[model samples]
Target: MSLRLHRIQRFVLSVLLFSSLVCVSCKSSEKITREVDPTVEAYSIDEDKAIDRLSEAIQHKTVSLEDTTEIVYDQYDDFIAFLEKRYPHLHQKVEKQRIGKYSVLYKWEGNESNLKPAMLIGHYDVVPVSSGSDTLWTYSPYKGAVDEGFVWGRGTLDDKSGIMSIMEAGEYLAEQNFNPDRTIYVALHHDEEVGGVRGAQRIAEHLQDKGVELAYLVDEGLPIAEEIIENVEVPLAMIGIASKGSVNIELAYNQDGGHSSMPPRSSVIGTLSNAVNRIERKPMKASYRGLIVETFDPLIPYMTYTQRLAFNNTWLFRRIIKNKLSNNPATNAALRTTAAKTIFEAGFKENVLPVEGRVIINFRIHPNDTVEDVVEYVRDRIRNDRINIQVLDRARNSSPVSSTKAMPYKMLKRTIEESFGEVLVSPSLFIAASDARHFHDLTSNIYRFRPIRARHEDRSRIHGIDERISTENYIEMIRFQIRLIENGAAEL
Candidate 1:
């Protein structure tokens, strides 16, 4: 009886100690957010002038069509010319060059040459409005109309606001003669909606050829998302430390053609469907470890008490945490490599089976997984010798994850803190590819962030009808840009 009591006491003590440890660990590492930056004055913009400039800027239909030849370069030229006229200070103050014909690169030489340059990149080319969706727009997609306290049009949020705000900030700085201690480069790409092959890629190559390494590169990516997570309503200023890689895999299963009535025991269509189902039902293993730690750590204190417990002691509650996170597509995408069956082609008609059946599966490779690993997963999932799998030519692995501890990141973070006060800032996985990916070879300190407040419903507006940005949000974007430029100045 004495021995049993001792054992029971030891067990109870162990549970108490563990619980204490977890409770202590659940405490926040840093304050949920710093007090609003009282020292730095908000960079003011002439609201009417800024809005008019953006409105006119959006009127140019510089759409990046899937077909390269279908893209109108004349419009791109006009857009470039418009910038030259509207922001004459930017053009006159910086050394400007045209990269890849329409894409423009500007170099604002700093007083200090020893420091590495900082770059701001964004695309002016917007995605084409889906056919027949134009009528859904209260204002025309290309009209760039300012009405009802919103800038209603395509590209208003996707990126034109980002580009215009950047230029406007730089122009304002130049007008005020605020010379910095580091060189600043801003590149506006002509094509980013498709793949950035002809625009951002060329600009990256141009910088590489010049042997120019950057302190950091900022491009249009994750934003200040509101209510991205359930029950967490605080806006998250997510800086994308890395973007997921993308690959399109074409799976072909072909057999002898036959009549629909007398199909073989295993037809090509059946085999292909099975392959698709296998990939879908069993996806790549989900992981909550690694970079995701920094992604959510800052937001921990803002989460519910139970939520904090699950995230705080991931070792004991990892499975429960993963289960909770996996329920949402956005959170799940951050947790693992996603496989989507984008295209499927089988029979030509109902009467007969086609000889060839092709299914295209697009995988957004996670930072933990490589392109090679993704291809292997596809092969293993299918496991059918008869099926032919080919990774498309454009398939590439994920970008190198940038350091959260690096000075450039610290600078970016400081900028966000000082500019958008009291906002919860955190690093996150950018599930979609951005123009920043093109500059991976240039530096490992690349950060993809678009300084705009967004919500779950506002996501589709980027490439959908009736896209718009609130008037106040547009003005705030310019202020963020101004602070980013000042904060990134050379201090080393």
Candidate 2:
């Protein structure tokens, strides 16, 4: 009996030891912290004047339309004239050239001519307010109203702020007689809202023809995301190292038109609806690879205990995590190639069945997938020979992933750290298309980030109503741009 008791005790001790080991292993490893320097001088600008300038920029109705011919050229011309008049110093210092008909490129010559230059790009074009939604706006979309400590207007958020901030930084620096070690090019595209086919594409081609090698290209993308990850409420400054590709697939089916009273079996509308349902039910596969993994790896330590446990042991919890992420629309977009049936057409009259049914599905391709891969997957999923599939408009594959080890990335990260103290920084995949796509051939190093403090509430405000930026956030953007410019010129 004593021998039996001893064996039981040994077994209990072994269990206790194993449990303790598991607990220790599951805890977060080591915390990494970045030191904020007290000696680093903070850049300041005229807050009132800056706000006024951004307000004025918003007043110009430089809206980009899907149909290029519908764009108001006079508005763009007026906007350009406004910039020239307002930033007299910048206009005099930088050699400015208009690319295509509306886009403008400004080159600031650095003292060190041999070094490859860095480029800062943003589009002046803003998406037009949806028709019949004008009554919903608190302020007129084009009025550029400054009230309640926010600049309210159409371009206030989805990127006139970026353009104004960069220009503000340059104008301020130029006035200070500050010269950089590397040249800087500012490309302001007017057609980024409509695919940038005319604006950014032309600028990139012109630069390529001139044999200008860029050290890095910075464009508008991921902002300083607040409360991005659940349970980790700390703001994350996400730098987009790559952007997702976009493709529109058209699924069309034609059938003989007949009276609604004697509807034939498997009508075109019915067939098309079934195909869409099938595609939606079985979406593109989600994987924990590429940017999704890269983004979460560094953030694991900052996550909650349960989240840390799951993320730390991706091998066991990957399926669970993927499912959880896939359930949420925002996280799902980050994980897989998302498909949305944007446009659907069928019968025009109530009593008549239409002969043709057309559905336009847009897919934002993940970096792991290609345009062809997306198309093939849709074709195979539908499995209907009668339903014809065709690529619509322009289709672009994902941009090549930029290296995190490059100096430009490091410089950009460091500048962010210095500007916004103690914020977590990580590389993220941009799920939307940007003008940076045009610059992929010009340089391997392209970083997409705009230093705006964005919260979940700001998401809808971007292209939706009441688009505005807080006065303080606007100042932060200017300071970030200033630091980025200075960092680009600093010694490696």
Candidate 3:
């Protein structure tokens, strides 16, 4: 009887042990499921450090081919060396190549195969500081001063912010021992200010030689605007679906040479002036169409219910919407291709009644439109066949719109959502050009967006005086980049 009792006790103990083990295992599984992954957080960046780095970068004065002696080459070289020293891990790990005299390229290897890599691009060069405006600047152009949470200098807003964000993100990821599933490239071009012929063009050619087409390329163009549309100031993260083709139209009228005292019924200047006025009077059709419509669709969700409903009723609401948004130049550029008379060449001497006079009209052609189309459009507007039309220089129109529905776009959207909470994500048409066009031949998915936000006045500072970006924005830009890299890899 005692032996039987002992067996029962041992059996009960074993059952209890088994139950405890099962409970512990279930608890461990639940914990694993509950824990969230690390993601980009807003306003959590090290502001001081970011400001320090930005300040140093600005002080370098890496202005593009614009100095008096044109001795900016040494400054460019020193800047490259500075990057090498700043990012030792990136230099040691990634394969490095110099395309143009100052174009810097670094490639980071990843895990998975078959997927084309992503290219993150930024220009290291800046426009020259204005010569006459010594007092116009709050801080010297190359001073790199940090005051009141802002880093003041040239290139801060134009592109050095982009370079800083890329480099910092790379360094952070390298430190974390993070290896992505696909290759990543970083390109810093020096001649973007002068038109990327020597900088971005060279990098594109080198990649083409390797038979490499990017899955998508991201470059610095437009950023998040606060009030892109009426009552819709969500982060307008423009993945440049396309950039407008450019055509330079010169209007000229020939008249018999005469003194100002003996002018004809209609002089060359008078005719040309009338034609220019006529062109201005009849503006490009500002209808919401093609890529411009595509750009507006994503923001509809973020709009208020009334605005959302209005946005949905495309036929009834587009004209009303366009009129409401047309008040601002920046916003107007988003809606349609723009034409401006940027330059004019007429009399040799100020007082002379020259026989020949010309006015140059600059047109940013919409993607669906071509140089020929723009020329025709100009001709039709002028109503005067006498005006000489010429194509000074043109680039093949931008790539066809990439699939915003694709995984890469979704990943970018997710990254933006994670990085800048509650900010709206949308595609936009870029009036300005970027290097993204070069990759379109290889891959159809090219996006142009920089993770930064600027107010209305700050936008002008891009190529203008006192160009700057906030330290907080700079750090967030880096964090967003890290998020992008991680999310991009996860798909593979």
lDDT by residue (tens digit), candidate 1, 182-222:
99999999888888888889989988999999988998888
TM-score of 2: 0.92
The superposed Cα distance between candidate 2 and the true structure at residue 122, in angstroms, equals: 0.6
How well is each residue in 332-431 modelled by candidate 3, as lDDT tens digits? 7766667889887778875668888889888777666777777777788778777676667653554477777877777777777777665666777777
CA lDDT of every candidate: 0.85, 0.87, 0.74
| Candidate 3 TM-score, true structure as reference | 0.87
List where candidate 3 sits over 4 angstroms from the true fold. 1-38, 42-46, 66-71, 301-309
Candidate 2: worst 10 consecutive residues by lDDT? 35-44
Looking at candidate 1, the ten consecutive residues that score lowest on lDDT are 24-33
User: Tens digits of per-residue lDDT for model 2 on 29-135?
Assistant: 44546654442344557889999999999999998998877889999999999999999888888999999899999999888988899999999999999999978
Winner by TM-score between candidate 3 and candidate 2? 2
RMSD of 3: 17.6
